[model samples]
Target chain A: MIEDRPLIYKYLRHDKKFPHVWCGGCGIGILLGSLIRAIDHLGYTKDEVVLVSGIGCSGRLPVYVDFNTLHTTHGRALTFATGVKLAKPELKVIIIMGDGDATAIGGNHFIHAARRNLDLTAIIVNNNIYGMTGGQYSPTTPYGQRATTAVYGSVEHSFNIAQLAVCAGAVFAARGTVYHVRQLDGLIEKALLKNGFSVVEVISQCHTHYGRLNKLGNQIDMMKQQRDSAVPVEKARKMSPEEMEGKFEIGILVDREAPNYLEQYNKVRQKAKNALSLQLTKEEKEESERREALDKQ
Target chain B: MHRRKKPEPKAQLMQGNEACAEGALIAGCRFFAGYPITPASEIAEHLSYRLPQVDGTFIQMEDEIASMGAVIGGSLAGVKSMTATSGPGFSLMQENLGFACMAEVPCVVVNVMRGGPSTGLPTNPSQGDVMQARWGTHGDHPIIVLSPSSVMECFTLTVKAFNYSEKYRTPVIFLMDEVVAHMREKVVLPEPNEVTVIDRVKPSVPPEWYLPYEDTSFGVPPMGIFGEGYRYHVTGLVHDIRGFPTLRQDEIEPFLLRLFRKISIHFADIQLVESFHTEDADLVIVAYGCTFRSAHRAMVEARARGLKVGLLKLITIWPFPRRVVEPLTRAKKTLLVPEMNMGQISREVKRVNQGMTTVLTVNKIDGTMITPQEILEKIEEEKK
Candidate 1:
């Protein structure tokens, strides 16, 4: 018999944390595999990778990875990652957060982190609903989708997270689905190599809570739903407004460059140091004036 | 060759907030994240100007919550980090402060208290957040809180706060009143060598054998920073010795107790109390923060008038300095607490008193300082 272990196994904590908290057949595992493969492909050492997560099913992903992992409070992963990236610009800090954790509770940090444009990778797992909290409605849950909190279907509209990231000044914003495993891996890898704040919103499925509450069949059915509904950005651009209803683009939505936070802060430090060197005391100022007068004479 | 004369060491007039910013730099704090609020904003503003000059990073966060989160993150990344806020902002920081305690991240939080249950007064001074600093964060966790009475103490105590945070792998609260935060006084700061600056202990063992939260002979475990090849996990959840979240009761019980015991066992070094004429006195006033300044004045005048009055100024607020305070409760006839809040720290003084002595409280919630004359009058009444 031939061995069939995956290449990404090198990045996993094999000695401990077996049987992760993610439910069986959940999309989180698929996205986690995509992340691991992306990191493995990038060839960055585990010592240089810092995986930061907020409190949720997605937050639990960092513990399984053999990296410098930090599982912070709900919705504050980006803020903590900001500190890490600012303190040590050499470390590659990757932040993971759930839909509700990212959009609702941590919305301010999410947008601000994008606006700050720190050199950090934010992988937002958009599972539509708060799965760990028993299928409660999240900011990304589609309108008219039934949730545990919204038994009669949600009235509020959902956010287009990739578009929001672009509007919030992220240098690179992309959307990929768990069904598109290869595409997610590429998107995450590209995001990891991006110069500024990069976001890869993974449209994943919470089969146990979200699927059961909305009568969306089972895990495989939801994965098939993701495959059917996702339109490529190239196709999205060519399609008419009327033909693009109930569809989201599944590729890089925005990719551009701006001066990232650390680069700008370096300039500020240089300016401050220059100013300090140029500054003179009262006696020095008086002596310089007297010397100038003497030279004129 | 004409050489210039070296500038003489001199005392300069500096604001309390300015002293705190200077103190942080001297204590090796390289990262600061804060949001602007009244009184405490000066600390952020001064650090914003000073940090970049020292090749340090200073960030103005969206709110106090993000500021605190960033502070903890910077600390975990092997840098001394801090954030400053007032009462309303401090309220926002409680959740993240609790997270820091649970994760044992070393950082400093300075709360320059303004009058408030909800933004009651922005510019006025109040010693109201004393109790909140101890219990604001959810869950039972150990915290070191230092209150400074003067501008010089503000500089010294801010350095002390960073040392305590790093030594214990815990968050230390630097509690200041609006009065102390804004008051300008002549202060000569000590050289870096004069004050002891401590850093967190790192693991001596290799990454394969390192446990981030291992129960050691000393309660505090060596802290490993991120990206140091340790590759350890850090979580806000009740975690085991390996820093991974565990549901086992055996790991959970010791984890909680160690958080408290780490600070408690080192109470001898943690407790800081200043006494003024306490020996051979019938009456003693227990005060802290800016109120201690007034009580000190009252004690001086009372002694001049032949009244045996003493003042115990509590510098360390959190562990309550029970060892020193409990003794005063039994030996002294009266323990007076004059504060700018409605008996916040006085309640602790009473609890430790346990009905052993008369605990008199003069609380002013009208956004005014407790005057020395008011305390002197109280002492006179006690004498009669």
Candidate 2:
């Protein structure tokens, strides 16, 4: 049981807004709890943080938190969070998005934000289907999985979000599952502390939609499946791609130190200031000499 | 208390787009997000260099949609933010533009008008987006759009756009055509003391009691920026004064009505139109943006030939300036509207005229400016 429940309660808006819209046996509540614990462990106050979310079931997470939150249009959380981070570089900006919200309509912004290496953390909750819209297939829905839109089973391939983030130039990329709360909390904290674009994709269970459609059993069975299917990166490195077909590799995929966009932007500002100051000093010297000459006359 | 003396106004020969960028800087705009588009690209280019000089942030977004979203985010974070785009890019910005209206986020969007339904002409002048700027975004929402006629006006109007956006808590569109955007003219920018800058009203109440969308008598609630200690929610949904999503009719109706009433109630302050030689003229030419330049010339030429003609140049196109247009139509004379598009704004002229006067349209849509000669010929033909 959480002995520091008071500390966690300080970070939540549990007034009449209690009992959030997340379904019973939903993994989103667990993920949100882990995020709160991570931020609490990092010692970041509510005033120093901002939570931005796009439109989806997971996107509703920000409205329940006690931070400066923005619930924006679907798939645009990263874009809006980028602006918030750039505008106030001192604040810790975090984005919560669903699988469809991140990789489908918002895919362009995802790649570009990663490529720019802006200082922001994106936490993608991947339930493999559009949970808010009733069991529709999403970009992350595994091929051959049954969704409402894929009644005959999905013909399209799924995206490996952690791998996609790594290839897209994200400075920090990792995978975590809701079943492993402690590890997921650590991954989220590490991603938030990274100086550049970071993504922690948590494979959540949508027992209401994705699980029911795919006949993946109840919430407890789904949690057990996730725990069994997730292979840590160190262990997975010993196996071949063929051996890791149905299992997802957990742990950090990419963690590298690179100059973030804000650092480079600061250099640009310094250069412009130096150039402007040089021009101003030259003008000032000329004006002083002219004034001295006028006095001599 | 010692006050720093204001710097004197400096005369500079600058392009309209550059002037618009400079005006944004003067208006306390510290953040800019935009994609490169022809005619309007200079605004982004200029700001990319100028913003950093002022310790402001400038980002070249991936597309116009993200640019608009970033601008909204920046505004929510307590910085005056802006984005510039041409017609095609402006079309891409409509969805978020509506979000800004519905959420009551204050920001400026500069649409340097180019010929387009879709990339019709990138580098050509067109008033084609006048109607798009008004009604392009889905649903009925209040919007303020100010079109600049000259390079000097581009500078002044851009500042006005930011002021109006902050004052009204809504997005203000700076609609410029390619003619004014690219044209170079000697502009005497106002001294710092001469200019009146408006900042968004912030909440005077304590942080715990703050409501982001609190319904006030003036229809505009004080906006609190992120990290300012007022942690309030903001959503695109139809929300109550607390900024939370609600479907209750009473809460939703008041919220929606206030969005419209804030602009409509202040029509006197928001509506701006410049009338030239329409005092005793039987022929009144209605035009805006670059076409107004040609209309002014044609009005003078027609008057010289013993024709009673005048020009009604629209500076504030949205909210339509019906008070100014209604009286002119009551005279029962011919009203000619010429534009670079095939009768977009002319339809508005006709609609406002309500058959009180003969509304004739002289349209040119082949990526060319409507020439003074063409408008003058139309005036002569209408007289016959």
Among the candidates, what TM-score does chain A have in each? 0.93, 0.94
Q: Backbone clashes in each candidate structure, one number apiece?
A: 0, 0
Lowest-sum lDDT 10-residue window in model 1 chain B: B1-10
Interface RMSD for every prediction, one decimal? 3.0, 4.7
**lDDT tens per residue, model 1, A1-297:** 012145657777886667888899988888888888888878989999999999889999999889999999999999999899889989999999998888899999999999999999999999899988888899999999999899999999999888999999999999999999899999999999999999999999888988998889899999999999999999999998888888889999999989988989999999999888777465589777777666666
Error of 1 at A18 (Å): 2.2
Model 2 chain B: weakest 10-residue lDDT segment is: B1-10
TM-score of chain A taken by itself, candidate 1: 0.93
Clashing pairs in 2: none
Quote the true-contact fraction of every model.
0.82, 0.67
